[model samples]
Target: MTAQLANVAAVHADEPSMPGIVPATLARIKVELLGFIRNPQSLVFTVSLPLLLMLIFGSVFSGPVEGTDVDFRQVFISGIIAAGAMSTAFSGLTISVVIEREHGIIRRMASSPMPKSAYFIGKVLMVLITTVLEVALLLLVAVLLFQLDLPATAALWGTFIWVLLLGTAACTMAGFAYCALIPNAKSAAAVTTPPFMILQFISGVFYPFHMLPGWMQTIASVFPLAPMTRGFRHVFLPDTFKAVEAGGVWNLQGIVVTLVAWIILGTFLTAITFKWRGPRVR
Candidate 1:
């Protein structure tokens, strides 16, 4: 008994002391951010693509939206902001996580002394930071180059903040849950990109929500991106524009409820489906 106790004590002494959650998460955040910065493709897709789309669409659609006084550019900017957030939170996370899993990084991390909760928290927080930066850059360009108007009231700004936070959280969790669909790193983009691209088109990122076909609008309504786009439009566009949205109203309560529902669903799915090992591993 005494010998066993000494062995256990030695084992515990050899093990690294676990850091507090904050410090551990912060360390993971730093690592993730550095990896993101080093990967030029991530920067281009997550940040540059949205900016390019904004400039092109903003320039091409110069006139006022049909049946409304608001510029089409303004509406497009709002949708694109949501698109940017989705790209960073959803598409980026899915692809990166799949790649890491396939490379055995996730497996190694699982066996390490690091707290899994801290690691995931770091990932989510990193995504939130990147999403915020991407959205801010988009807004800056929208305001400086496209002359997009800022929210006129504090209430509108409040709406923007909550919508941004909730929407991002939903997308991040959804991305984490979606890793189960990807079979390997090779198919990550193939599995993830189609849904993301389709959502952008049908969810009003590339066009006006009210002008989409009835079927498309119905599909978009069920997903998170459409509601996020509508929420953003509420912040930047005139209140009168809400008359043109589905059901002829802004539906602020509905937006919150939809995003919150997605957050819950995504979290549940992630809890059940996420695997530390690669898909093919025994």
Candidate 2:
């Protein structure tokens, strides 16, 4: 992706007087956005799946958390917000790329006269837009049905922003790297769904992290999603809720470190392994 962007930059440098680059980028973005919004499969992944999970979990656990005053509904809402972002940013993006590759859309785009960087930027922007909307929908539902309160302080909102942005970046890069694993678009769902579902269960999205066995918690901690959910909990839940977390404390430092590390690792892996050709062509 960086190489593609560099090629674009070189082209722009050579044609410094070109006045249509901005318009071209915007045109690409508009086209991609329209395609996404019109696709029912995209809507299911980006909108319905997360909202359904949020509704189910929030309704099922409609009480204060055991041994704490914090409401379980609130905890589920916070966790599901993170999970929704993962659904849209990581799983959603990965599967879309796989299908596009299978259908030769990516290959066609590569052969097009459009700037690769513009296409790449347009896709990334679409991911950001969809993920934000997914989170917003979850929050709106939580507020209306469960009466979730908005975070009041600057620090809380600041932490929420950091976690959301960092988590999205980490997950998006990781999704790109994951594309190398899908041998065909047919197997994309088979490969992607199990891991994401398992992560959600073990990483405290479906239950409290501490309830899992110590070894399982340790394993979950190695992944970005677990820390991402924890970060959300820290900002949204009361400080006392940390008592039940894996370390019995809010590990903001660990959250930041793990997410940043994953972002870098994912970027490196993506640059090395991402394939432009689909399985049939390869």
Candidate 3:
């Protein structure tokens, strides 16, 4: 299966781009955004999952972090938020790219005169909008359903947005890396979603990180998903919950290290492995 997919990719060699466009990046973003919003499944999962998780977990937990008085809902609020963003940014893009390749959209794209930078930027723009809307929807739910308050300090709010932006970028890069490695567009979900779901469970989205067994906590902390969720908790709540990972401060140091490292690793892997097409072409 792998060798067959590699040959298909080698055969296509060229992924086309749209030509004769006015502001191609902006145009492409609009097209992509329209397609995504029209997809009902995308709406439910990307936009609804965060809100749903916030409601359910907030009601179910009914209290603070195990070791501290800090509200677990307040802390896990960020985890759910991060998970939603990660899913949209990662699984969504990987699957989209795979579908585009299978359908000959990328082949059509490479044949066009539009620049590769423009095409890629357009995808990022769509991601940016989807992420912003998803965040807004989830935050509203967090406030009303989970009682998770937004950061009152300007500095924290700024940091929250920055962390979210960087975190989303990291997830997107990972998605691209998966896109590069996987052989068939048809298998994209088969390859991506199970791990994504499992990671959410282990990354402390469904439970507090420290509450998990020690070995599980260790494994989760090393993954980008856990770090991003923890960093986001710092941005959203009091410092107590982030203490689940590190003892004090906002732990900006830990967040910066984790996200930057994963972003770099995923980026390098993607560039080395990404293929534009399948060999079989069918």
Task: List the candidates ranked by TM-score, beginning with the highest.
Answer: 1, 2, 3
| Candidate 3, superposed: residue stretches over 4 Å from native | 1-22, 247-249
Off by over 4 Å in 1: 1-8, 280-282
| Candidate 1 residue 8 C-alpha distance from true site, Å | 4.3
lDDT tens digits by residue: candidate 2, 112-219: 666666665676777788888878888888889988887879989999989998998888888988999999988988999898999999888888776779899899
Q: What local lDDT does model 2 show for residue 166? A: 90
Clashing pairs in 1: none
Task: Give me the overall lDDT of model 3.
Answer: 0.79
* Per-prediction TM-score to the true structure, in the order listed: 0.95, 0.88, 0.86
Weakest lDDT window of 10 consecutive positions for candidate 2: 15-24
Name the 10 consecutive residues with the lowest summed lDDT in model 3: 13-22
Candidate 2 pairs with clashing backbones: none
Instruction: Estimate, for each residue in 1-282, the C-alpha lDDT of model 3 and write its tens digit.
Output: 999999899877765434544487777898899889899886787678777778777888867577888876777778888998887889888888888877778777766677666666777677878988898888887787767778989988888887888888888888878887677777888998897888888887888776788788678777678877877877777765556564545568777788888789988997788666665554
User: Which lDDT tens digits does candidate 1 get at residues 184-207?
Assistant: 999998999999999999998888
* Strongest candidate by TM-score: 1
Candidate 3 steric clashes: 10
